[model samples]
Structure formats: C-alpha cells, structure tokens
Target: MTKRNEPLAELVTEAGLSEGGLARRVNELGQDEGLQLTYDYTAVYRWVRKGQRPEPPVPSLIAQALSERLGRQVRPSDFGMTDTASLATRALTYNSDVPGTVDTILELGRTELKSRGMQRRRMMTAPFVLAAAAGPSRDWLLSTLDETFDQDAPRKIGMRQIDGIRGMFKIMQEMDVMRGGGHARVTLVEYLSGYVLPLVRRQHDQEAVQLALYEAAAEQAYLVGWMAYDDGQHGLAQRYLIQSLRLASASKNKVLGAHVLAGMSDQANLLGYPEEALALARVGQRGITISDSPACMADLQILEARALAALARDGRPKGSVTEAVRRAEATFQHVRPDNEPEWARFIDPAYLYGEAAHCFRDIADTAQIDRFASESAAEAARQHRARRGALSQAALVSGDLQRNEIERAATRGQTVISLAETVESSRCIETVRDLTKRFKPHGRMPEVQAFQARAGQLLKVA
Candidate 1:
C-alpha cells in the first residue's frame, strides 16, 4: 500500500475544505469546461485517505479550485499531483525566450533528446480545454520580437540542411494529400527528431541561414501538429501547434506565424470551440494584408466564416456567417496563383469550394451544399487532390442524407468510402462516420443499414 498523509489532503484541510465541499467544487469547475465529472464525497474521501491522484484534467481542476479558495496560485506540484500539464504552463504556455523555446520543443517532441518522463497517454486522448490554450492565443497576438538565433552549442550547420528540410517537406505535403497524415507521420517525426533537431541546436555562422533553419523547423513542427490532428489526437496537436507558433516567432516570419495560427484556428473549429476558432483566425488575419497575400487572407477569412457559422448554430450573436462568407469569396477572387506563396498555393477554386461546403454544412444550409460540394469534388478531381475529392464526396452525401434522398446518399456514401480507402486518412474515415450517424433516422430502411454496416466494416467506427 502507498503511504498516507498526502499533500493534497493537507492542502484541502489547510484550505478548510470539507470532503463533500471539495468534491462539489471540483465537479462545478468541471461543468464550466464541458466536462461531466461525477465527483462526490466518497471520491474525495478516497483521495484524501489514500493520497490517490485523480485522472488527467481532474488534478488541474482540483488545483484550480484550491487556487480560487486560497486566493493564490495553487499548482499541481503544490499537492504532489503529477498532472501532465495545466492551463497555464508547459505545452500550453508560449515561451518568449528564443533559446528556451527551442529547448522546450526539443524536449516535448519525439526527439532523441526529448525527456523520457513525458507521458503521452493524456496528450493522446485529452479533451480540448479552451482555458488551456487561451493564454497562448493572446500572447501570439501581442508578440513582436527582434530575435537572435546565434547559438553556441558546439555543432556547426549550414544552408544544405535547411534546403533538405524544405525539399522533404514538399514531398511530405504531397504525401499528406495522397495518403493522409498518418501514412508517413512516424517517418516524418523521425526525420524531424533525428535530422532537424541537430540543425536547430547547432551554431549558425550567418543570420540568414539561422532564420531559414528556424522557419523550416517551424513548418515541420506545424506539419507534425497537422498529422496529429488528422489522427484525431487533439491535445497533442494543440501542444505542437503552440510550439510551432513560438518557432515562427523566433524565425521572424509573421506570415508563417499567421499560418501557424490558422492551423490552430482550424483545429479549434474541429474540436467544437467556435469562439476560440474565430479568435485565432482573427489574430492570423492581423499579420497579413489582403493586397499582399490574398490567398492567405482568403484562407483566414474562410476559417473565420467557419467559426462564425458554428457560433450561429450555437445561438451566439457574435457575427454573421453570411457576411463572413461574402468577405472570404471576395478576397479569394483576388488570389493571383503565380504570385502566391508555396503554402497558399492550395487556395484555388476547388479548395475554396470545399471549405465553403464545410461552412454551409455547419449552418445545415442544404440549399448551398449541393452546389459547393459538387464544385468542390469536381475541382478536386481536376486538380488530382484525392483527399479533398473524398471529403467533397462526403459533403455531397451529407446533403443527400439531409434531403432524405436515401438512394442518392447511399451511392454517394459508397463513393466516399471507396475514395477514402485509397488514402490512409482518419479525417476522411471520420467524415464517413458522420454520414453513418445521419442514417440513424432511417434505420428501418435496408439501404441505411447497408451503408452503416459498410462503414463499420471499412472504418471500424460503428
């Protein structure tokens, strides 16, 4: 048996909290963040008696409760709790010190130098907490630094390594499109950890070379986060994106930083946080002007529109989805493909249509879904982007399902499944999962069951 008289029990007692009261306070705190915790007096007594630590975010919540009562910062360490991370520190915090940021990323990521004490279990499955990322978002907006990357870490590196990162990243981007982020993510992580970290840690004789290295490393980190998101690992993705934001800041690349924020905004939208999504997209937009990079501007605008649409659905009076959509479309029109950056090259008609289809999907506006989804699929096929083709087909299926066109929806659903099979993409599979759920109302029908069964067989998501 473990020893008794835990620091948690002492802290609770010192705070004058009763067994029932601490349980009640923790449960109430959980509610504010959408967690349906069922803590009670018995659970509290067990914790106090055995010095047992609660699971995951509960430790953070318990500390928060005590902090509120004690009118000071009460960290998990204060009570000997080993929470992986809290709302204010570690992965969630945006480190402004350039050298510290690099070291933090080296430790947090899947590098040889990364600490073995890292517990990825919680990060792999943790829920998206708005409070955890809020500070980073605010910090990113207020950030502007004239940074120096002249490190004296003994090792010497040059532009050849930077070129290799950029070259391989291009191939990786294509692989992500062709075979999903999961297809080659482990190899990519190995490359980032094994090949990239050494370049980052070394001394760069020239300022330009150092900046390029940081920027390339930032892009790789962002891609890692994207891969994690595609695999549905939300917490892991959030932390990587936060680190990527810091890297971009150190590189002095505002546009790249904006792109990083765009990824954060995109993930927030996926995880059901419209307010945070909109906030991130808005911050991303502040860095670049429309005339300078219309495609980049359009990407942020559509992301904002998505957040606005989600808010509209949630009955919040933040902004008009329709107006945001108009702005996105207008800005997209100004996109000169040849002049666009390498990253913004995907902002063509088909890409815009697919994103717009999502906006329409969020609002449940089936009126616009058919046109946008059809155009999106057609454009994706024309451009040879199979992943978007699959997602677009799924959107079409969503519309057909909504219209009660079961035959059409089932056929389209089959198309999505077949296309999804072509790529090892969890996002495409997830889209089909939603299609299956939409079939629930028509469960009495054979076609719906067939589609559901087929999805279960293919995606293992029944």
Candidate 2:
C-alpha cells in the first residue's frame, strides 16, 4: 500500500485539526456546491493512510475547506497532488468579450496542425473534445440578438479571407474524394485555423455571425471526424459529427445542418452501418426540404441517394437520384446568388452529378455510373484546374467503367497524393487506398503494379 499521510496530511496536522474534523469541514464545503459526500473519519483515515483521491468537486471543496481553515490559498497540489490547473485556467479565461481569447484558440488550432503526427493522436480525455465540439452551438444559441457589426468598426476582414477559406474547402473536398479522409487531415485543420477561426472573430449581424459560426463549427467537426475516421475511431467521429449537427441547428442554417448530416451518413456507410447511414441521410433530406432552397434541397437529395445506394436500397436510391438531378438542373437554370455563401455555391449541378455517379457506383450500376460520371467529368473539365481532385474522381469512375486499370490507378493515385500534400484529412488517403485495393487482387496490370509500388515508396517516407 502507498503512503497517504504526505503534505496534505502534514498541512491538516499543522492546522491543528483531527482527521474527523478535516473531513467534516470538507463535507460541509461539498454541501455548499450541492455535492453529497459520505465522507467521515474513515474517509479522512483513507486519505491519510492510503493516498485516496477524491472525485471531482470534492478536490475543490477540500482545497476550499483547507484554505478557509488555514487562511491561505490551499491548492490541491499543496496536498501532495497535482491540481487540475489547466481546466481551472480554461474556465477562468473563457471570455466572449475578449478578442484575444479567440486569437488564442486560433493559435492553438494552428499549433495542433503544425505538430507532427497530430492527426493520429487520440485524445486521452474524450470529454474535452466533446466539450470543445459543443462550444460553437452553445455560443450561438445563447448569443444576444443585439450583437451586430459596428458600422464604424475597422474592416478586419477582406476578400482574401473569403477566397482563402473557399479555396481550402474546395481543395479539401477534392482531396477527400480522390484519396481518402486520412491524407487530407492536416490541411483541413490548417484551413480551420487560418480561415475559419479568423472569420469567427469578425463582427457581423446576429444571423450572419451565427451562420459563419455554424460553418466553422461544421468544418471543425468535419476535420475532427475525418481524423478519427482515418484513425479508425468510428465512435469518436460519430460524436463529433453529432456535435456538428447541433451547432448547425443552433445557427438555424438548415442547409449546413443537412450537409453535416450527410457527412455523418457518409461516415456511417464507411463503417458498415448502412441502416444508420440511411437514417441520417433521410434526416438530411428532410432538413433540406425545410430549407426551401432548390440548390440546398438538391444537394441533400444527392447525399440521400448516396447513403441509400450504400445500403443497396434500390428503389429509394434511384428515386432520390432522379429527384436530385431534376432539382439540381432547376436550380442551375436560375441565376446564381451574387452573395451566396462560399460553401453553398459548390453544391451545383456538377456536384449533384458527381454524387449521383458515386451512388450508382456504390450499387454497381455501371450503366448509370458511366452516364453521370461522363457528364460530371465534362463539367469538371470546364471548371478551374484547382479543382483537379473533383475531376480526378469523375476520371476514376469513368476509368473503372472502361476497365483502364493502369490509367485509373495512375490518375487516381497521382491526384490523391497531390491533394493529400495540400490538405490534412486522412479520408483522402483512404479513398486512394480503397481504389488501389480494388486493383490489388489483379496484380498483373503493370500500371496498377507501378502505382502501388510508387504509393508504397511514398508511404515509407511520409
């Protein structure tokens, strides 16, 4: 047995208190905090003789009791234990009015991105991640309606801010499609830190502010889930995605909420939880229907089709795909919004087409996949080269249709790794790996062989 009568015991002795007396004082303090404690002489004896640690709140109460009795700042550490100082400090430092606190959070996020092997690091205390994940929603829900940008306030934001954020989001999405979430994990975190965090600091109308916060929170949770997904932490990823959904709800942004739900569905499908994926996708579709935006509705429908296809729900998937196509075409027929949210603008006909192709591919519907994939490929070709990752996905589906093993592997592998270099989501790498796995059984294909060799070499160094 370990010795317990150490510094805390010494302190109690110095205070001229019997073991029963110290326990009584500590129990009284616990009552003030509405904590019921069964502590008595035996508990005090256990602390003194066995180094017994009290549960949460009890430690603070003991410290408080000691401080009051001794007339000094008696900390937990003073009792021969390390205090939970970090949590205490975080609680004390949390300030909605202080801009510096926001900067600090951004800086921490940046540091996390820059650290080696950060994406692979599993959080020891899951509650901390859960707490942080819930923060954006809580802030949005409780924020005052009077909060608005000051007209005379300095324009701390600029066009570059918007461009950088949109660019990163696009890049990450492509990387995610091409490789897997694993490869793009770090880039996503960097984007969250450099782009999303700063935008969160900007002053705006209550609605705008909430919307921005929702996007940031969703993106943050996306990255978090992506990392967890890459590392095979399904439960953690699900929790983050759920928290993201709550944040989106708090913002009253139905479209974004649908997007988050779709992402969660994707993760569910990936983990072989097909029923859960279908359920989440249906929820996303309902949310989009309520959103009343044709573009948003189409995007959600496309996501629903993807989930249903994963579950091999033939009729539902086909109907959802048809509806998505019709809705997306209708949305594109109209003039696009001039001041559209950057993330929303990406959810157009091309996006829906690509997603539809993916759904068909999941269900092994080569004919439908080929048709949609070809159309999406043509659209992607016309789009900017920066969107090479998205185009590469279309190329992947088409190459699969043509049975061009070498070209498919080479193109998919190149685009995937290239995207991985820029973004930090491991999902991107996993996507590429999955493609490569499909060709592994047929090892005779020289191009597939070569691509695998190259990828193996890259992994050794990476």
TM-score of each: 0.75, 0.55
For 126-196, candidate 1 gives per-residue lDDT tens digits of 56657766777667666643333233321223557676788888888778777787787777777887788
How many backbone clashes are present in model 2? 23
Provide the overall lDDT of each model, using Cα atoms, as 2-decimal numbers: 0.77, 0.56
Taking every candidate in turn, the Cα RMSD to the unseen true structure, in Å, is: 9.6, 9.6
Q: After superposition, how far is residue 427 of candidate 2 from its true place, in Å?
A: 3.1
1-462: candidate 2 lDDT, tens digit per residue: 777658878888878889888888888877887877778898888877898766556666777778887898675545744223232233223244434334334433433443223221422122323233234333433342223323342212234544466566666755654455566666676666666766666666755544556555555655555565654555445555555555555445555666666666666666666566666666666544432455555655566666666656534445555554455455545425553344555665456677777776766666677677667656655764223344346335445734654556465556555554544444445555666576676577676687677657555544
lDDT of 1 at 326: 84
| Regions more than 4 Å wrong, model 1 | 1-89, 111-120, 145-158, 316-319
Best model number under lDDT: 1
Return the top candidate by TM-score: 1
Clashing pairs in 1: none
**Which residue segments of model 2 deviate by more than 4 Å?**
1-120, 124-239, 313-335, 378-425, 459-462
